[model samples]
Target chain A: MNTWNVAKLVAAKDLRIEARSRVITNQVLPFAAIAMVMFAFALDNENDALLVQVAPGLIWLATLFSLLILVQRSFAIETADGAIDALRVAGIDPGGIFLGKAAALAAQLVALETILIGAAVLLYHTEIRLGGVVLLVTTVLAATCGLAFVGTLYGGLAAGIKGRETLLPLLLLPVVAPVLIGATRALEAAFGTGKAVLADGWPWLGLLITFAAAFGVVGVLAFGPLLDE
Target chain B: METIVDLRDVVAVLGQFPALAGASLTVLRGEIVLLQGPNGAGKTSLLRVCAGLLPVVRGHAVVLGHDLTVDRSGVRAKVGLLGHTNGLYPELSVRDNVQFWGTTVGASSGEIDAALDRLGLSLRLADVQVGRLSAGQKRRTALACLVARRAVLWLLDEPHAGLDAEGRDELDAVLRQAAASGATVLVASHELERAGALAHRTVQVIAGQVHEVEQ
Candidate 1:
């Protein structure tokens, strides 16, 4: 296999492993969904403007939490059977492994985001207009990219950390905050929701892209060192 | 006569810990070199550096004419590794696991099947999920990946620890065949007597340092 081919193989392997385990479904996704649903319920009666104002952060935060918690499952595949060492010894590119894992994580986060969006509409009684859809999808993808990139590294590092169950969140949040900030701001732009032109979004989207790109490059370069560690 | 593998006084340090130090080793085309060492002897670390999987703080390593420090991506394509973990997709059936790794290593389906045939796994365990396989079978399946890969260098780490007699023989034949076919083999094994049968030369390592042991 070539570059993307190896990535696909690695990602598909991760997905298959995730399917077999159900850890993502049982632990991370459900808790995140419940958290989102509860937040929407808790604030259902508050001032509409206030809820809208915070909605961007709340939604992105929930999604980011879920991605951070769940995406570690992708890394678990390697740490479980010592597959990371095997892959490294196989002379496989750590970059390919990272991208493959990030890809798998992106797929899982997209699914979870769709579930949350549905929950927001039906259970939470949140509304989505034309521009709302654009903003939501953009926020979901951009945030997912940033979290997936950062999470993969920490998840691998956490494999060695003492209190990984508790420490993973602490290790991940600070590194990923910039991406989170840019994404939250971009989603906040959807507040008034009349026209919300793409030009208005161009900068935030650009920032999001830069964060994702930087995370990708930096994550790839740095993960090798962490793995070697 | 080409040197498919070369290493020159390789010193690799991980922070304060020394992983491999003053490690000079080589594997010419079709040579089978058995690497035996106790735990923490840098056996895995040495193989990893050779495969370009680990960073070497000093010294140079080249595999198939690709430098470990510089042209790692190029060298990686020409090497196959079967470590203690030995690349297995537990969720996938034996066939699928083989096929997926084949894709990553750029081996064709026919080559994978032939590899399985060489390992005697082509018929019995084809459809079984890899997770269900026993330890020896997992090791065999990993070796199957090596057969399928047909790379220039085969890095086998602790490949024969849990195998039965037949399994051990099978792995021995696999290594011998790979070496005979002009693929340099660097195996780090705990099974010394068994390895003595197949290895052309044996090199010992201790606590991240190399020692010459002719047995």
Candidate 2:
């Protein structure tokens, strides 16, 4: 088994575990859906117009929280059976473990984003052009890549620490601020809400891509040390 | 014989505390060295050091001919550690848990099945989730991983802690078999009587230092 092969195996194991447990499918997705509904109700005073106007931000917010939960669950499972130690001693490349985790997180976040996007479309009565749809999907993928990389990096850092569940967000949220801003701005431009920044949308997309590529590489390199005890 | 583990005044700190406070010991290939110690005596830490899970903060330590201070990760591929925890995924079936570990180390399917069979995990039990198994069964599944791994150095911490009489016998047989195959086994256990019967030699730990015990 090579590095990528091992990573795929690890990710497949996680996906299988999730498929059996349905912890994310059953719990996290509903939590995201309900939270998005709450956002709609909270801003009900502004009616559908206001809700649709801010749909991009609301969707991104929901995805961010969902990503947090997903990352926590991913690492928590590794600790359940001393899986972390197992990974360390198994002799597989540590980078494989990191990439495996990040890949799994990205897959789950993409699944969650699909559901959240559907909910956003239905509840917010949002209208998106064909071009806007392309931009939205691209933005989600880039942002998810960056988020998954950072989340996996921070997840390993926070594992086994006191109050790690609480500590993870503190470590993660600040670093992902750019992802949120870039993703939302790109989405906004896609929706024609960023009238003056329409031409600038490409730059925002570039930011998302850069963040993804940078963190993806760093996470692969840094995961080995972070995972080591 | 080549030395599988050699440590000279090794100091390994866990948090603010020194788990292996100037600990030192050596084991040649194919020897079953029993590690006996009381609680907080650093037996577990010593095994971790040998398995390359812990870096020696000071002094000299080498495992499987790989220096602990240099490239600990290099030793990991050939070393298998079965700690107090079963380290098998609770959600995964006995088969899946064993398969995961076996596949990680590039073991063949035939080897995996042979290990499971050797550990007496029946076809029925093989599909059962680890959480559903008794503690003894979980330990067996964990042992199956070590068998499948066929590692050079086996570091077992409390290998007999949760086993029944039959499980203990099975584990002893496994340890003996591993040793006969030229694998070095370092076991940390409080069960001195059983461990003594299985080990070629016994080394007790006290306050993070290793001392030889006369058989």
Candidate 3:
């Protein structure tokens, strides 16, 4: 089997496994809803440039947080049933497993981002046009890839440590700050532009793309040593 | 037949403590090798290093002509390892668990079912979430991986940990069948007499070194 099938099978199995948990939806839906509610209260129906300046970042941040909570695919079940060793023994590459996990997390992130955007429109009076929509989608995809890519790597590292849940964010936040910063800025620029121009935006966009690529590659190589340990 | 596992002065130190300080052993194709030791005699550690799970601190283990230190993934492909953990998914039903893992290792559906049958895991249990499985059944589930994907080297760490008499019997049967198929089997066991039944030879691990048993 090629790398693509390895990734696909891993992702498919994870989704099917997660789908069995009726509580997963219940757990994720609230995170999306509340983030939107927080936006209304914090923004107070204001579209001031400062708030709008940061809106994309704020929304992306919320989505990332929600993904962090919802991305329990790598953490929760493995601790309980010892399912991860099956993957280790099955000859699946740790990096491929990371991609499988990231793909699954992205699906959840997309669903949550949709809710957040909807909430932004109804609650915060956020203006979103066709260009804005395309940029929003691109930003979230890149941002989520950054988050999932980094999150799954630390997830493995912290799996064996004490206070892992708490330890993970601390370890990951610093590594992912660049992506968060870059994604937030790109989204703001995406909203501010008149011609959907990307003169100033590419730097941040490039940072995000670079972050995802670097994190994905390192994750693939390092995960094997960590998994075998 | 080529020796599936050949270790040369392999020493594994975990977190400042050396588990296998200067251990060496050779396991050939079609043999069941038992590693008997006290609770912390490095039996599992030695087996893991041999299976490419643990890195060698001092020396190297060469399995199937692949160095465990250099070609760990290659060693992994040719070996089936049951870590100290059972590694089952609590949310997935038993059948999904087996099939998910079966496909991951490139096992055909029929092969998975047949392996499950050999382990005495009922088809009905396939749909039941692993959270509901009894400890014995969980061990059975972990052992079901024995037939996962035709791995030549079966590295079982404490395979009988939670098994009942019947489960141990099932494991013995699998070991015999796997050896018959020319698969090299290495089991780390605390159960002395029972493990002796599974392997024609026993290597006692004492203070990170392995030596053959003498009459």
Candidate 4:
């Protein structure tokens, strides 16, 4: 079977399910938004300058937490009715399945990140410079891809295992440390926090790109074995 | 008759437990073989092994001309296995679930529609989410997906469990039609009287071993 076609089909199926279920929009999104608000409230007693300085890190921290929930939700669908086994038996390419799931996850994370960034702008009074728009967009895309790839990979690893709900974060958090740090740093630069220049963020974007590419390759090759296990 | 499945002393493991210990069975094309065994007798493991979902640890096994020991994934596309769960997405409509699985095998829209009709899933029912359907209806939907797949080998485990009398009759008819079209079927079921009537041969699975009954 053509991997591209299978990827498209799987991605479309997942997105369609998400659209119908409304779990991401109704539950995960609100949870993420609430978490962001909580972060802002935690810093309410602190000075406004401190909140502005830390807005990027706080936004990404919320995104990372939400990533865990999104990953759990994505794999839950496959294991809920033993649909993963059906997919395996159908002989759809494992790499295609991995890519399809990751793409869908990336799409969802993009939406989540967009809202979180908006919330940060309003809650933390962070300013966006014209020169940083390209950098910020690039950082979001790259970091989202990195997180999605890792999430899908680890989610597949934890799928079908007893206690996977708890196991997923354990297996996932350390692996994504680089993404959290790299994305936060890049965003800090893009947002002109800590007096960092846009040029400084480009190097961080390189790390994000490499992380995404590495996991993308590894996820495609490893997903089959993980799914079987 | 061409051999559709050949397993000689197949040994399969689930974790540390030997799910299939020295099991041997052979099935020919266009034949329906019933696998009857008590719980934990390795019946599902055997079907999974044949479908390429389970590994053959130490055995010579081939299904649909693919050496499973060499490449278990190769035969997967040509075989359909229906396990305990219906394998239908609960959130997706009956038609969407059927269409998704059917699309994997390159089944056309016409084929999907025909499969739905064959399973007695009316257009109105087809539009309903599988989660909302009755147990028998969900089974029918999963069967519709298998029908649309046009698999050369069918591996069904307790396929009649949740099905009603009419649904069971429909399943029997679908299996017969598939076998007549040269598809091999290996069904593990407890409903011996019902399954035995539809099977061309009956094999007993006792403690992960196969013993053919003189039918």
What is residue B174's positional error in candidate 3, in angstroms? 1.6
Candidate 3, clashing residue pairs? Answer: A82-B87, A82-B88, A83-B87, B95-B126
Q: DockQ winner among the candidates?
A: 4
Query: What TM-score does chain A of each model score against the native chain A?
Result: 0.86, 0.95, 0.87, 0.98
Q: Write model 3 residue lDDT over A137-191, tens digit each, in one string.
A: 6777787788878888888777767787777767877887797788877776666
Better candidate by TM-score, 2 or 4: 4
> Per-prediction TM-score, please?
0.85, 0.97, 0.89, 0.98
lDDT per residue for candidate 2 within A76-182, as digits (tens), equals 89988787997888888877888888898899999998888789889987667676777778888999899989999899999978899899989999999999999
The lDDT of each candidate is 0.75, 0.88, 0.75, 0.92
Candidate 4 Cα outliers beyond 4 Å, as residue runs: none
Off by over 4 Å in 3: A22-24, A42-54, A71-73, A189-206
lDDT of 4: 0.92
User: How is the predicted docking of candidate 1 categorized under the CAPRI scheme?
Assistant: acceptable
Q: Ten consecutive residues with minimal summed lDDT in candidate 2 chain B?
A: B83-92
Measured against the true two-chain complex, the DockQ scores of the candidates, in the order shown, are 0.42, 0.79, 0.54, 0.86
Of candidates 4 and 2, the better by lDDT: 4
As a whole number from 0 to 100, the lDDT of residue A179 in candidate 4 is 89
| DockQ score for model 2 | 0.79
Docking class of 3: medium
Q: How well does each candidate reproduce the native contacts, as fnat?
A: 0.53, 0.75, 0.65, 0.81
Q: Which candidate should be chosen as best, given lDDT against the real structure?
A: 4
TM-score of chain B of each: 0.94, 0.97, 0.94, 0.98
